[model samples]
Target: MKSGWMRGIIILLVFVLGLSIGYFLPDRKEKMDVPVASVGDEIITELMWLNQLKEDYGEQVLQDMIDRKVVFSEANRLGITVSDKEIEQEIQKMRKAYENDEQFLNSLKEQSGTTLEQLKEDMRYYLTWEKLATKDVVVSDPEIEEYYNNNLYLFQEPEKVHAWQIVVSTEEEAKQVIRELEEGTDFSTLAKERSMDLLTANQGGDLGFISLNDSYFDPSFLEVAFSLKEGEISSPIPVEKGFVILKVTEKVKERIIPLDEVKDTIRKEIALSQVPSLPQVLDQLRKQAKAQILINDNGK
Candidate 1:
């Protein structure tokens, strides 16, 4: 009986798979029809929308489609029309972000299955909706001041130590180096001659000003480094691979940066923090305008 039930479940699973396969299979005989949303005459097709979503955010493609539909509906109601110049600027920004890599450009083209022109058009629409949603938000001077006061620690620099390091692969070699250093041999010269970390060895193992918040070095080494004063050298600290000797070149005091220097940055951050409320504002604007979505094809 159990074997029979398992066979029945297997048959049902296969039938579902067959239906899914049939649904997705393209028809060569018929011309692909454009999907129309209920609100507008704009023709959005399944392939076109899916390709765009997959190109930009593969993980949240479905959520993106839903959000795009909502944005489009809201945009129409709000009379949020994006200008050609605005679209061009957005495309320019995106191009700059990916300019260093040819592979990224090629991958975008391949994933979208569209020309660069189409991609720019989509970005224009996206940015247009975004602009409409953000149109009414105003950050007052008081709000900025309050935010700065509340988060003063965020703008304050932490105490930091400027240090030089020497790493070697063996304890005996490290002891020998430490003996030479204690006898007044130059740390930088010894680092250049013996340190194993190639990236820093060339710079005489100078790690530069290491903030207390820096987690790259071993905690044991950091504890010792922070306790030392400027121009002081630490005893050889043992690690998994070998021993490390650190010299404190300088120390920096912690202090808050002035608000004038970071005013614009703080304002922008405050604006971005309020981004979640944009769609709500857009919805309010949408109630005053007219829009529609015609097709409801759930393309997987």
Candidate 2:
């Protein structure tokens, strides 16, 4: 019986492997013949172009394909060449990233309609253009500093408050609670006994630290709560249904950290902002280089 069970398991494994390979192999084979676009003597097939599209824009796959071909033509004109060894290394990195999941790797291969080898070649072309852009674009430290100064408000931390609240349905009940609190009633005990906010009533109505812009509480409540000094309690603030009395347990000042602490982040942002000029540089290179394009469906 054990021997029969082992045989069955082996057969099942073989069947699954066969199905997976069969499903992925057709897409890979089609990728070899698929015509994407042409750059000079290089013919990028439909499979190669679609794979590039999937990496960048999954929704508008065809547009990405056209854009990639345009970029590739520009890269070739600029003499931005990627070596086979570089492509191999990228493929190895991808394989490592998906090492734990064989199924995921297989699905990626099928979805791309290209084998792992072809994907690496596509990646090589993409990286070569990226490297060229990085090396050629000029963004100075002064520019970064200027951007930082202009956007200082974007980095300011808003004031935050931590407080406890008690919501009572009736004005008389609210007044009675205030009177009891004046007579030394425990706020937490009173909240647990009478407050209607089920989530925090047991924890003495502790609402935790909330930002001034928090949408949960009413604007009137926030206005009064923010104005109160720490440890000060507010008078019953009228709401839609009842009244809310709050104690300002804690208050944190808005903080703006120094730019020096984030200089590297600022520099990267500055560099990225200069990327649009790369294609123009590539265009100049194309004017100086020899290129050819052959379209199979010229009339279309």
Candidate 3:
């Protein structure tokens, strides 16, 4: 019965292996005789291009394909699965490191050469492997509490303000804007119409949430911004280009995030620390599965 079960698994693995190879294989619609590129009438045929790729990258590419298959098989054996929602949550976690979603997507494409859909699939595979690797690892509540206590600095939020601005070329123009604002002319409307800072003007001079440590805003500008209470507007302040009016929309005081807020994150970190290195886990899984390499660079 065990031998029969092994045979079934091997068959499934072979099918998956073929699919992996097909992903890297050249398109069937393009004939091997077709020219892939030309340098002054010296044509590089599709067949030649494929042959070169096979010789140069075949071994490593094949190894990677096998590794992916092994990870999938092991994950299946262990009944571990990565849900789409989990993948999305992981992506959201990564996105926090970037300025915005578009910026994150652009960076991902430039740095990893992958689309969002491709990244989702990659995340699925990765999350699956991570689960398999850390299945037995556990983080106690005390460990989480200790980690939180030791890493208090990591959880602190600096004082920040959500602010807007209306920049003008001269102090007189800035003062005029302040007068209009005082008379109940909407600040955002004035910003859109009169602000000289073209970048934020259309968006009603929104600077978003900013901290003193941001370094993007001038020290003078930051000082004026931080001095204002929420809903208070600053008088004309001199900056590099011209005079500017500032409004503080919201203020967040510096505070350490509570242990309850970061406990799940700390738990994951502690559990991850207990898992073996990824390569070590993969090697052990491969050995247990009795994986073999049937082809080399020579394709024999």
Give the Cα lDDT of each candidate: 0.66, 0.63, 0.76
lDDT of 2 by residue, 214-291 (tens): 787788888998998998777888888688778888899888857885665576566656676646645544454433
Report the Cα lDDT for residue 6, model 2.
27
Measured by lDDT, the strongest candidate is 3
Residue-wise lDDT of candidate 1 within 1-300, one digit each (tens)? Answer: 112222323333333344334446666112324463434756776445434443444434333344556667667777877777767655554553331234335645555444455565566555656666565678888999999999998898888888888999988888899899989999999999999976567778887777776777778888999999898888878987688888998898988988996786677678767776655755654455443334344433
- Cα lDDT for residue 291, model 3? 84
Q: What CA RMSD would you report for each candidate?
A: 14.9, 17.4, 8.3
Off by over 4 Å in 1: 1-138, 179-186, 275-300
Candidate with better TM-score, 1 vs 3:
3
Between candidates 2 and 3, name the one with more favorable lDDT. Answer: 3
lDDT of 3 by residue, 52-77 (tens): 66666566556666777999988888
10 residues in a row with least lDDT, candidate 1: 1-10
**Deviating ranges (above 4 Å) for candidate 3:** 1-32, 45-52, 161-210, 215-250
